[model samples]
Target: MSERPHMSSTSWRRSQPITSGFGAGWVLVIFGVLAFLLPPGGTAQQPPDPVPPVGVAPAAVEAENDQELQTIFRSEISFVRVDAIVTDEDGNALVDLTADDFEIFEDDIPQKIESFKLVKHTGVFDPDLPPPGTIRNEFDLEREAAREDSRIFVFFLDEYHVRDYNAMRMMQPLVDFVETQLAPTDLVGIMYPLTPLFDVTLTRNHEQIVHALRQFKGRKYEYDVLNGYEAAYAHYPTTDVEKIRNDVSLSALKALAMKLGGLREGRKSIIVLSEGYTDYVPPQLRDESAGGGGRRGAMRYNPLAGNSRMEESTRLFQDMGMRANLVYTADIANRNNTSFYMVDPRGLAVWEYDMSQVPIDHETDQSMLRILQDTLYVLADESDGRAIVNRNDIGPGLAQIVADQSSYYLLGYTSSEAPTDGEFHEIKVEVNRPDVRIRARKGYYALTEDNATRLMAPPKPEPPSAVSRALAKLAEPTRSRLVRTWVGASRGDNGKTRLTFVWEPIASGQSRRDESASQVMLMAMSDNAAYFRGEVPSRPGGTLPLAEFEADPGELELNVAIEDEYGDVLDRAVDELVVPDFTGTDVALSTPTVLRAQNTMEMRRIAADPDALPTAGRYFRRTDQLLLRGEAYAPGASPVDVTARLLNREGASMMPLPVELSAGGAYELSVQLSPFPRGDYLVEVSAASGDGVATTLVAFRIQG
Candidate 1:
C-alpha cells in the first residue's frame, strides 16, 4: 500500500427541537433504511455476540436497553448531513443540476433511489446572527443557519506520512478553500492522527473558523528518551510511538465518521488531509483476539491509500449529510527549498497528490514565502472533492469543489449482505451518458451491530418547518433548552482529587411536550473552571441517557461553563464548592452574621417587617437607653462573643446590641451608623467561641 493513498455521531447532540411540528417529511419518508438481515445467500440468526470494542465489552460499552432503544428508533429520522461543492470537468458549481443527474451506490452495490431533493440555506425570517469567534459553544445556530443542516467536515491531515516542510506547503490551498469555499453557515474542524487529541473547534462565524484553520499546523509529540518496554514503565507511557501514533489515528478517523453519522440533516463532507495508515505487527487489538475488530494485513504505510477510505468514509459521510473530501500529499521538498524527492517511509507524510499542473493565484505569493504543495489527487478524487498540485494554481481546484452544483439523485436498494461481521464491498455509480463521470459514496459498512445504525436508528427526517427554517438561520438548537448539571467533588484511587459531572436535560424555556429537543454537549470547562484535554460528549435523546465523567480537580478551577446543544453557552456558574477536590486544598471556611435593634428616649419607635427593611434607610428609632453590640463567627470554630460599644463621634455608649446568625455561616453585619444628639451611651463585651475562630466587631455613633 502506498503510504500516501487514503482519507477518512450523533450521541452528543439532540436530533431536533421537540416542539417544532412533527412535520410530514419524517412521516412521509419513502426510503426507510432497509436493514440487510442475512446476506443474499446466508443462514439463520445467531445470538449477537456482545463485543467490547476495547475488550471487556460489558465494562467498556454499557449494555443497551431494548425498550429505550426502541423509543429512540421511533424518534425522528435524524440522518447526518454533508455540505458539498460538486462540480463538473470544468470548474463551475453544478447547482442547476437535478436529482436524476446523480446515482447513489453503497459498498460497491447499486442502491435504489430514495428521497432526493436540492437543499440550500435560504428562506429565513431573522437575518442578523452572531459571528464565529472561537469554539465558544458546541452547536452554533448561526452556522446551522444555512438551512441545509449538513454534517460536520472533519479534515484528517495525516502527519505520519508528510514531512514538516511539505505539510506546511499544503496549508495554502487549504486556506484558500476555507476562505472562498465554506459559506458563513458552515462549521469546519481540523484533526490530526491521534485519540483524545483533537483541536475540535466549531463556530458559525467564518472569520473565527478561518482563524482557527490558519493555526492548524500538525500533531507534535515528544517521545521518551528511553526505550518503552518492561512492566516497570509499560502501562502509562506518555509517548509510546506505537500506541500514540497507530490505533489513535484510527480512533480519530472513527470519531470523524461518527460525527458525520450523528448529524440530523442532509449529507456530510469529511475532508481528510493526510496520506493514510496501516497497523503494525501482531495486528493491534480490535475487539477480542478471536477475530477482533478489523485489522490491516500488514503495517502497510498507506493501506487503502487514496482509494481505501472513500468507500466507507464517503458512505458514512453521505449518510450524515456528509461527503468526504481528501487532500493528502505524495511527495516532499528538502529543507534547502531547491529540489523535490519521494518522502522517506519513516518521514511521516502519508497522502500525496499530482502537482504536475498547478495554477498560481495572485492572492498568495507574498514575500519570499517558501511554499511547496504536494500533489494529493487520489485522495481528493475519491472524496468527490478536487485535488491540486502545490504551486500557485490551488484556486482553480478549490473553486471546482465548492462550485460543484451538479445534479444529485437519491437512490435506495436492499442487499442480502450479512450484518454480523465488518466486511468491505465495492460500488460503482454509472449513468447512460457520454463523457459523463459520476462520483458518489463508494460503499458503506453493511450493518454492524452495537454501532450507530444498529443502535438508535437515526431519528426520522423532518422537512424544515417555518420556525425551524427561521431559527436555523438565526442559531442552531432552538429546540434545546438549558442543561441542568450537578457537579460533585471526590478523591480517586490514585489519591488525586477529582470532580464528577452529571448532566440531565432541562426545559428549553418553551412550554409544551409533543416532543422536545434534547441537549447534547461537548464540555470544555470543569466545575472548578479548568480546561479539558480531551473531548466530552453531550447526547440529546433522553433514551441515550445522561453520562458522568471524572476530571482532575484542576480542571474544575476554570470557572464552570456550559453550552446548550446548538453550541450556545447559556450558563457560567461560580465554583462554590469547598470540597478538597473542588478547591484543591482541605481548608473550608464560612461566616455567620448577627444584628441588634433599639429605641431612643427622644425619638418615636416604629415597627415594620424586618425582611422589608430598607437597605439604605434609617426609619426606626434607636434606644440610647441601652447599648447594642454585635459580632460575626466561622464554622467549626468558636462563637465570637464580641460586643460592639455604641457611641456618637464623642465616643459615648448608645445602647446594648442584639445579634442573629445568617444562613450557612455566611454573614452580613449591620449596626446604627446614625446620629443621637445631646448625649450617648456605651456597651461592650469580648469573648471567643473557640478554636481560633475570627470575628468582626466595630463601634460607631449617631450624631446630633
Candidate 2:
C-alpha cells in the first residue's frame, strides 16, 4: 500500500485564515489594508467564502450577507443559526415579534443578530395549490423537505426499552397521531433501533407509516435472538445486554439527528416512543446470562447480593457514560435544529419490574423507575422539547409536539467570540415582551479548527477517465424485465476481444413476472456478420449462467431473450456495447471480475483456482470476502505495473488495496467486507507501462 501525496502548499494556504488563531476582527483589518491598496473606485475584492456553517445553505448565506454587509470592508465570516420557539402563557405562538424584540447572547456575551425570519408552517396543503408529490427518491425527499409549508417528523421506536404490553397499547395513539395530527402535506418517517438511516424514507404516504407502526412489538427483557446482529451477543450477561441496548438506541438517535440535519436547516422533530433508557438492570431480574439454560437455575434472585462495592462503582461509571451520550446527542440535535420528543409508553406506571418475572424490593423498584423516567426528561429538556411521562392521557402532549414544530423564530448571529474550541456553547435568546415563555435549544457544539479546515478544503481529484467510464456502466439501465445481466470484455485470441455474458433471474419478489427465468438466448453480432448465437441454460445450484464469444474490438450489438422453463419468451432486451481493444500496444486492462467467498476455506479455494467463475450479482453480504481478478497488458514484453485501490461513491480514494500477481500472470486483490460498512464502493485497478497508462473501476454494494 502507498500513501497518498500531501496536499499542495497553495491549497493549505487558501484555508489558513479560516482556522487561524486571529479573531474575525483581525481578519477584517487585514482585508481593509488590501482594499486600500486597490485602485480608487474599484470594487473591494472579497476573500474566498469560508465553508457555510453546518445546516446553513448557500442561499441563506447570500440572504444574510445582503442584510448584514453595510460597510465597504467584508471578510469571510460564519454565522451560527438558532431556531427559537416563543409562546405566550396561553401556549399561543408569538409570530409577530420583530428583530428588535429579541436579543441573542453566546457564552454570556451579547452578539449582533445577523439574520432573522419568522417561520410559520401549518403543515397543511392549500386547496388552490397543487398537491405535494410522493417521495420516491432522494431528489423528491430533498425537494419536498425544503418546502416551507411542509414539516418533517421521524418516529424513533425504541423497542428494546419498552414492554410488549405497553407497545401494543401505544400503537393506536401513534396511528391516531398520524391520522389526525399530521396534515397531508407533512412528510413522516419511522425507524427502529436497528433500522438504517438510509432505509428510513420520509414520504407523504401516511398510510405506509401507520402500517409500519401497527407491527411494532417490543422485546424488552426478552432475550430471544431475532436477527444475526443479536445472535452474536445473545449469550452475554443480562446487565451487559441492557447496556448494549442502551448504546444502540442512543447511537441510532444521534445518527437520526445528523440525518435530519442533512435534509434541511429547519426544525425537524423525532418522536421517541419508549419506556426510557437504563444502563443497569436490577439485581432481582439479573440473569447470569441472557440465554436461558442451566445458568438460569444457578443464580437465584438475591436483590442485595449483586450490589457490592465493585458492582456499585461499575454501575456509576456506566451511568456516567450513558448520561454523556445523552448530552452529546442533544448537542448534535441542537446544532442541527432538531428536537427529540420523548414519550413514555408506560403511562402512569407504578413499578419498573413485575414480581411475576423476578422478586424485587419496593425500594429498588421505585429507585429504578425514577431513574428511567429521568432519562426521558433529560433528553427532551436538553433538546428543548416536551417529555410526556407519568401521564395516563398523552393526547395533548402529542399534539403539542406538532404545535412546537408549527411555528418558530429562526435567528442567525455571528458570535463575536467566534469560539472554535469544539466545546458546547450556551445560547440565551431573550424576547423583550413580558408574560411570554421562551423555549430554545440550550446550546450547540462548536466545530474544532481541524474540522473547519477540512470542511473548507478543496474537493479531491476526480477519478481517471477510464475509471469514470467504467463506473458509468454501473448506472446503465437494464433492459431485461425478468433478469439482470453482466457483460464483460477481456483479451481474446488473435486481435479479437473475449465477451462474457452472464445472466441470473431477478430475486423472486423483485420481478413482476409470474414465471421464473430459466435460460437466456444470447446473440452477438457485428455490423457486417453475426458472431455467436445460442441458448445458455441457467445453472441449478445458484451458479450464474454464462456465455462466451469472440468479437472484433469495436462496436457490437447484443440481443437477449429471457425464457421460462417451457421455453416461452418472458422478456427481451437489446444492447449496444463497445468492445475494448485489449490487444493494443498501449497499457491496457481487461474487464475486472468480482467473485465472493463465504469463509476462509472458500476464499482460499477461489484464490487457488484462477478459473473460478465470477458472480453476476453486484450485491453481497457484509460477512463475505471478495476477490477481484483482472489482467493487465502492455506493448511487446514490457512489464506492466498494476495497483488496486478502494474508492467511495464520490470518487474519493479511501485506501490502497494490495494487488498480488498470480502464477497465471493475472492480478488479484482480496477485499474483506467486514472492514467496510454497508454502502456502495468501487475498486480501481490501474496499469502503467512504458507506452501509456490505463485504469478501470468495478462497482459493488454491500448489504447487512
Return the top candidate by TM-score. Answer: 2
RMSD of 2: 11.3
User: Candidate 2, which ten residues in sequence have the lowest lDDT sum?
Assistant: 3-12
Q: Cα lDDT for residue 507, model 2? A: 76
Candidate 1 lDDT by residue in tens digits, 407-505: 233333344343334443444665544554455544433334554355444445553232122222112122333443433333344544444444444
List lDDT for all candidates, in order.
0.35, 0.76
Best by lDDT: 2
RMSD of each: 26.1, 11.3
- Please give, for residues 1-704, the per-residue lDDT of candidate 2 as tens digits: 21111001011111112111213233333433322222112233445566778899999997776445432232122357788899999999989999999998888889898789898886667566556777776667767787878898999999998889999999999899999999887889999999965566798889999999999999889889898889888988888888899889988887777667766778889999988777876665567778666266233567554446765665567667777888887876776678899999998989988755766566667767887888898899998888999988888999998898889998887677666677888889999999999998787776677754553444587766544544444442222246767777778999988888877777766544467888999898988879999999998888778988899977777877778899997767666767777675677777778889999999999888877888776778899999998888778878778888999877788999999975334798989999888877888888887747777778777868
Quote model 2's TM-score: 0.76
